[model samples]
Structure formats: structure tokens, C-alpha cells
Target chain A: MTMRLVRTELVDSREILPGQWLQSFLAPELSSGSRAGQFVHARTGDLSGLVLRRPFSINTADPATGVITIHFRTIGRGTEWFTRLRPGDTVEMLGPLGRPFEVDPRSRHLLLIAGGLGMAGVRSLADEAINHGRQVTLLFGAASARDVYPSSLLPDEVEYVIATDDGSVGHKGFVTELVPDYEGWADQAFACGPAPMLAALARIAEGRRERLGVAKLGRKRGVGKPDVVGSTAARRKAFLQVSMEQNMGCAVGACLGCVIMGTNGVPQRVCREGPVFAAEEVAWESGW
Target chain B: MSPADLSVDLGRGLVLPNPILVASGTFGYGIEYGDVVEVDRLGGICCKGTTLQPRIGNITPRVTETPGGMLNSIGLQNPGVDAVVAKYAGTWAGWKTPVIVNVAGESVEDYVEVVQRLEGVSGVAGIELNISCPNVGRGGLQFAIDAGAAGEVTAAVRRATDLPLLVKLSPNVGDVRPIARAIADAGADALTAINTLSGIALAPSRRKPLLGNIYGGLSGPAIKPVALRIVYEVSQVVDIPVVAIGGVTELADVLDFLAVGAVAVQVGTAIFADPTLPVRLVDELTDECERRGIASYAELVGTALPPKPGAPSSKGVEYRP
Candidate 1:
């Protein structure tokens, strides 16, 4: 569906962690229309001289409850403004934007990975995968147990694993280390995290296809057939897809603010082409 | 009540159906508003600044908010004039409203070259010279501050094209009258004053500047007074019509610009806060004219221009002192 501005009321706000917040808005229009990997450009309170609306990934959307939640850290004035909004306060949002993660129908097992606040980027996919009768294994990394997302918020069907940087939780190392154990089990992997972690995951995903001589989905149809590299079909056939983040303007592709260097040498707009892209489409080390 | 009576001849027989034109940069290439704003309703659309070549623009943090306003150091990030004409001309040609191409360049040759390329473009209706983008250090200030340079470029572009040329004036210059007069003398169809005022904001940490470019151009409601001052001064000196820009956020601002001798106004920074403003202003202006029993909105223009010495407002007055 095309994107549009919507007004939603604050249903609830809670401190999911010490400095992290999970706020739910009562937006039936957004909850029903939005899909996994889409985001909302939320209007913040016009206090503290903030002008730009903050972009947040939809953490969870419950069409039955007509509610959508966003998870964020109180990094600056814009996010702080959202936390201060009282229940029943109406906030405007331009929404259901950017392309969603294209899951192949043939894939039955989906492996998800997230780092800290990146959970919001991949959270909805777990719900979507479970509803589609797919097995989901979520590998999450945080600074410590206190920073780990509560398992209670997730669907009971998901097998959740955690990695804390300080050894205060389940796995005591980087979350990428856990992917090898599930590489043979997972049909496809999707990740969202800091640039370094996503880069690491991309490297692993690239090697997995080669090391296993993995006959990628749809490959049986033809070996040398030319498929469009960046299309949803190509992304679904790949072993890994990643969600990216950048500072944005217009959020509607007018201003080219949120751009990431693509493998094609031209900068792709994160708001238009994607906040999500296949691992190979991005120039992982362009530093942009 | 006839719509034909509202048509205005903006020199060289380039008549506008009405007088409400969306300013350059703020409206992008006129397609940015999408379905939210009806582009055909506006009198015209002045597109974003187009250079001879594509510009990557300034570093990150290009825009920020200031007190009752905002600052932008966009650095004229465009995909060159040719790319723009190639990409948007077909779409623009399909529209009823005229699309005025806002041109900016680094030198006299650059200005002439860009305008020459725009000549005879089917979609393009006119040229709006953005000679006052303050974010760039070099070419931006050179043409705006010096009258001779401004006129030199204007005359060069005039020689290059028969298109309606509207030269935008910078508020940074001291006394815009001579500059306005020089531009008018060079045969510009109209004048647009003023572009943004140069300003800087320190970072919150106070260790560095807030904007990535270290400095930015001040716009929005805060610069309305400065814009009014420059427009008021330039209107008295120039014979050609003056279109005003800078800090026009509401209907009052449009009226204020008209009262201060601006034939039309361009809404800029305010489009960020309210994208529907320009369209709303067009409706409000017509309603305002109807309420005042004026046949056209042009009748409201220059109503506060300190009555030229022997005009009606000064005819009966005497030196009582």
C-alpha cells in the first residue's frame, strides 16, 4: 500500500529497559495496513525546538487490538519527546513506508538476528513468521542482561537466544557466533544491527552458500538464468537480507538524505528503495 | 467573476492564470508534494536549484531548526540542469501550471551556459536565478554581494534566452536598491528578494557548530522582517515586478509581502511544517480579495509602499513641521 500521514493516540508507554522505551499507539489504520520491515515517521512534540519527525521501525502490530508498538532508546530530544507523550495524546505519523522483508514461501524455518535497539527493525518478522506456520529462531545481542529484550513480549512459538557483551546473559560473545549452529537448520536468515554486526552476518551468509554448495531456492528452475539482483524474488532466494538505518529527510524520496552506498556505485535512498536490502546490494565498507 | 480577468501579464506576454507561485527549492521539482498538494492549482512552480552538474552537496546534518525558524546548508544538491530537464520535463509538460526552472551556477559562463541549455525546453516556462545560496563559500557570495557581477550574469543569461528571467536577491548585501536597479537595468523580467540570511548555530556541546557545514542559511518566520525590509527597499527602486521569498509561513506573510510591494510571495521553510500551506494561501488570497471587493489580488500589491511622493496618500499632505 502507498504511504500516508495518520493520526494515532498513545495507548501505552513503558520502560522496557533502563533507558529504552516501548510505546504503543492505537492506530488501526497503521496496524492493519503495515507489514513487517515497514516503518512510521512519527511526529514528536514540538518542544525543545525539534523540527524533524523521528522515523521508527514498527516493533509489533496487532490488528485485532488495533495497536502498533515502537521500541527506541532515549538518545536525544526527538525520542525523549515521544516518551513524554501521555496516554490518549494524538500524534501524527506518515507511515507503512519502505519495502518489507520478502520471505520466500518455500522457506519454512526463518532465523532472525538483532543487536540492541535493532530489535525493533526485526521484531515484527517473528510474529509474521509464526503466523505463517514457520519456525522462528531469534538470536539477540545486548550489552548485558538488563539490556536484553524481555522474552515474555515475544510469541511463545519463537525460540529466543541472547548474547551479552559482558557475559551477563546467555551467550557471552557476539551474536554472530550463534548463527553457525543454526546455519544448517535455518532455511533463510535476516539480520538488523550495528554496521559491523550486519557486515559480519553478510560475510557469513556469503560463505555459507559457497561452502555448502547450497542450491539456493528457485535455482533448480535454472542455473544460468538472469534474475534481477535487487528484486524481492532475488532477495528471497538469497541466504540473508539486512535492514539499514540512516538520518533521513522528507521520508518520501524527495530529499536524498537517507542514502546508503549501493554495489552499483550510486547511493540508494533508504526511504524509497529500502530500509531493507539484500546483503550483496550494499557496499559494506563504503562508510556512508 | 470571469477567470480571464484574473490573468496577469508577467512581462514578455508570459501571463499567469493567477499570482500564487510556489517558490523554488521548497517545492522540489513540483512532484514531491504527490497527491497531497494539487500542482495544477498554483499559478506556477519554481523548481529546486539546478546547476550545470550534479552536486553531492554539503556534509551530513544539512538542516536544523532555530528559534521560530530553521537553517539549511543544502549546498544546492541537484542532478544538473540536463538531468532535471530529461527526468522532469515530460511530467511538467503534462501539467497546466508553468514550471519555472531555478538556476544557480559558479561563474558568469556557468550561468549563461545553464540558461542556454534551458532555452526552448517544452516544460520549462521561465528562469528563477538562485544567486544567493549562502552555504557555499565561493561562487554563491560573488554574484550576490556585487552589483556589477549580478548585472553581468543577469545580462549574460538574458542574452542567452528569451525565457522570463526572475533574479532572486540576497538579504546579506548592504542596501539592495542599487543591486535591484542594476538587475532591472539588465532587462530581468522580475526580481525576487530576498534569499536566506546567513547564520550559524553552535552545537549543543558548545565545542563545535551544530550544522555539519559549520554555517547555514537562516529561513522561516524569523527572517520575515529582513525580507520585508529588502523587498520594501528594492520595490521603490526597480520598475520590474518583485516577487518576495524568505520566512513566508502564513496568509499574513503573503499580505505583508504584497503590502510591501511584492507582486507575489513564495512559501519556503514553512512547507516542512505544513506542506499544504501554499495551496491554502492561494485559496485564502482569493477569498481575501473577494472580501475586500477587489477584482484581482494584484490590487493589494504595493498598498503600503509609502506612497511615491505625489500619489493619492501624499497629495493632500503638507509639511506641517
Candidate 2:
């Protein structure tokens, strides 16, 4: 909710993979307040034919240096416009928008899952978890080793695991296959990926409790309490949290453009209500 | 030269401090931008499309970007009229600008009920009848295309509330003048020319439409010329103030709209790219008037209009049977 229209200067821009980029900005007003899963709506310098501003997740933020970075691939003309910028160029951005990944204070172990470009959405959380003295495990999936996110870019404290479709990396298969290995050990899971991938993870998270045979708690104070779905407290206690993306318009609740149907039969704004939500909160099969 | 005047009077005692109003659907309830935009500095604020009942709106992929514009089929998703007035009216009453509620409904009674509820509200300043919303299945577009339906709805709402009423025109119609005239004659204080034109974009898979509802209203710079043509034609035929809205991005676009006889221009799709553009345009417009040494911006209206009668909206208008 601490949002501002700040003018950020592109201090660094580099291509880490074949077509993927890692660009950093000097935004003092935003880097500190932005959380792990929040995003910034970056406007294109050349809006000659491109009208809408592109939304990018805050990949990493360094409050000490007043720097924040965004990761993206050349998907369309709007993104291509960002690749053409040089050092010291200015970009007008509105941030840090949407809800961030809510971590329970008592949790000591955290698991993060990402697919392809979805890495940008969860990369910052590793820093947050490590800074809080929590053990972190990151499982990533990519088409091939060429597209795999470089491990050096991550915090050294993170336990990096990778799966490539072509078997050019540690595991040969989808990243979801790696979740079961750590599901029991990790207290909670966070993810950002393709819809099918996230949906598959939601299915897995839904069955984890019964699979582990965790005892159903009896009423403590007359009734067993449960967190309300889609609420911040509910997300803070959920088994799995995800950062969702959609084709956005205003990057605010106004346009009602970037929405995903919730389990409660109401459409939630990815900009205002969340970029992050509990897996149970989303109606995965609803196909919104 | 003295300070240039930017105020706008839409008649029936609804006078705006300026002419740069934010279009509905883009600004939300004027709080989405947080502190980025100075809503009090705007001439007026047209909030999101409101209906009689709470609506959840359309499904996924509700918006997409095209060349020089964007397409959206939000399907009038709102928390209903009663919820809207209960939530934001108090905050609006404290602001310096006017907040015009944009009402959308499936029937004439629905429109009247929504307006009547807002009639005596303290924060509610006026009403903009959205008779041209094209997102919903029965989204009131029928009134926008036909003169009789347009007049009927306006007359009903006119009787229900004494608040300043402005009926928005849709550019999807073949000829907009008759409908514009009917609504004006039926007691609309102002006319907002050119709602979004209907359009669709293909999905990347090429197997389906990009938007969930399959069709959306096109807005942005792509629709500016079409809006100008409508403003020029309708202004000549209607006596009420013409408020043009389609794709206003910069001060030049604002001036261009004024030249075609729009007393005010609403900034719509451009807000997605730059939230501060509307407020900046308000300042730039005053600077523009000072540069021209004009005492008031009103002298700039209708400059592109013809000096004589018989000037058709387009070259083929007279040829149409």
C-alpha cells in the first residue's frame, strides 16, 4: 500500500541467458518498501504504437544501494522497448504493487518453485527467507540448460535444484516432480510458474495433509479456528502460496482486467487483491 | 495576459473547476492510484460503470494491447450502486473537484433507480448516463444506437433525478447525430461523444479470442480520429455542451478535441501507461492558453468546424440514402 510514482534510472542492463535479461534500476523510494512477490508497472520509453505499460515483478531489491532489478524475455514490442535502454536512462514506474508473499513467522523451512520466466516472481524471496534465518530450497524448471536461471545469481545460502526437459541439468523432468522430495521436510511452499504447473502444484498441496496423516485438531476454545480464505492471515498460514500473472491494464483494481477466479466464485484482482494468493484460494480448474 | 480560465460549466449548476476529467473504468473510484494522481486537481472524475446489482464482471484475459491502443471487456464489474455510494461518496465530498457517477444498467428502470439513489447524496455531484456500454450481454448499447431508445432512457432518468445528467454516445453506430440530438432534446445537460468501438484480438494459439467475453471496446490513440469525427458532427447538431472522450494522451490531443467543439475531454486508456498524464495535461493546457494569449480556453472550441452549413461529417454522408 506504500505506492509511489517514482522515476527510476536504469543503472545496469545485461542478458543472462539467450533471450532473457536482468535489468537493474536505481529507485530509492521503491526498493525499501517493496516486498518479495510485489511488482512495478514500468512504462515504455517509446509509446509510439505501444499504449499500455508493462508489469514486471521485482526480481531483487537492494535497499542499501537503492537498487531493484526486473527479469523479462522479449515477448512483445513493449518488452523490446525496455531492452533498448542504456545506462542512466529514466523509466517511470508505479509500485510496489499487489500483495507480497506472506511468510509465517514460526516457519523455519521454506520451499520455492519456479518455471522458466516465472523465476523473476520468486527470486527475491530467497533473500528474504535467508535474511530471516530460514533454510531455503529452490526448485526450477526450464526447457533446456540454455534457459535455466544461473545459480550464481541466487543467494549462496539457497539450496538450488534444477530440472530441464532435455536432461541437461540435475533432474530430467518437470520441476513439479521435485516437490514431493521436499514437501514433507519444508514447513510451507511458495511458487510462481505456468498455469498448468501451478495448478499441478495446487493439486499436490491439497493432498499433502492427508498424505502426511497430520492429525485433525479438535476445538480448543469451543470451536477450531480457521483463517478466512484470501485474507492476509489465511495466506500467512496456508500450505502453498503462488504469485499469479495476467494480461494487465491499469495495474490497479480499477480496470478489473488482470483477474483470476477464486474458490469463492469471485474474481480477484492480481494487482490489488494479489499477485500472491494461497493455492486453496484459487479455483484452479475454473479456467479463468 | 491574465491567468487562463480552465473551468467548465456543463449546465444545471454542475460547473467543473477544469476540463480534464478522467474517463470511467480507468480511474476506478479515484483511490486506486493512491497518492500518485491529484484527484482534487481534476475537473471531474467519472467512476467505474455502476449497475443496480453487484457484478463480478467478465472472465480471464479481460484486456489486451493492440497497435496504439488496447481492448478491454470488463463486462461492467462493480460492487453495485448502493455499495459504490456507501464507499466513496464521503471521500468525494471533501475533494475540490466534481465526481460524476457513470451509471450503466440493462433497463430504463435500472438506470433510473441507480440515478435516483445518487440524487441527493452529498458527495455525488452529477451523473453520466452510460447508455453505450458494450461489454455486457444487455449492456444498454441498444439505447446508444437508436434515437427513440436513447431519448426514452434519458427522459426516464431525467425525471428520476435533478442531478446534472450527461449521456455518453457510442462510436459503434452508423450515424450518431440523431441519437445525440434525441438525448440532448430529452434533457441531457451535456453529451460525451464516442465510447469505445467494438473490437477483438486473436489469442496467441490462434484457436480462440484473446478476451474472455470474445469482444471488447477499443480505446487509446487508435480511436482518436473516429472520436474527433463524432464530436465534430454531433456538436454541430446539439445545443448542449459536448464532452469528447476516446483516446486523449497528451496536451496536443486535448487541444485537437477542443478544436472539434468538445467543451471538455476525458482521458481514458492513456491512464494505464501514465497515471499522472491527466493532471499534467491540466497544467499544460493552461500553459497552452497562456502561450496563445487567450483569456479563456473556451475560445478554442469548434475551430475545426465549418464556417457554413451543409458540411457533412464525412464526404459520403450526403451520398447515403
In CAPRI terms, model 1 is classed as: acceptable
Q: Give the candidate number with the greatest DockQ.
A: 2
Write the residue-wise lDDT of candidate 1 on A1-288 in tens digits.
667678899989999899999999999999999989989887666722555677899999999999999999998777878889999999988888888898988899999999999999999999999999999999999989999999999999999999999999899999999999999899989889998999999999989977777787778867866445457776777778898887665666665556677787666667777888888888888765
Q: Model 1: which residue pairs collide? A: none
- Report the C-alpha lDDT of model 1 over B22-135, residue by residue, as the tens digit: 777677898866876788888788898999988766664666767766677767778898999999999999998888899998877788899999999999889999876432
The C-alpha lDDT values of all candidates are 0.83, 0.91
TM-score of chain A of 2: 0.96
Q: Which stretches of candidate 1 lie above 4 Å from their native place?
A: A45-48, A215-234, B1-9, B133-141, B199-213, B311-321
Q: Write one digit per residue (lDDT tens) for candidate 2, span B95-167.
A: 9889999999888888989998998999889999989743244453467888988898899999999999999
The CAPRI classification for model 2 reads as high
Clashes of each: 0, 0
Q: Which stretches of candidate 2 lie over 4 Å from their true place?
A: A215-229, B133-141, B308-321
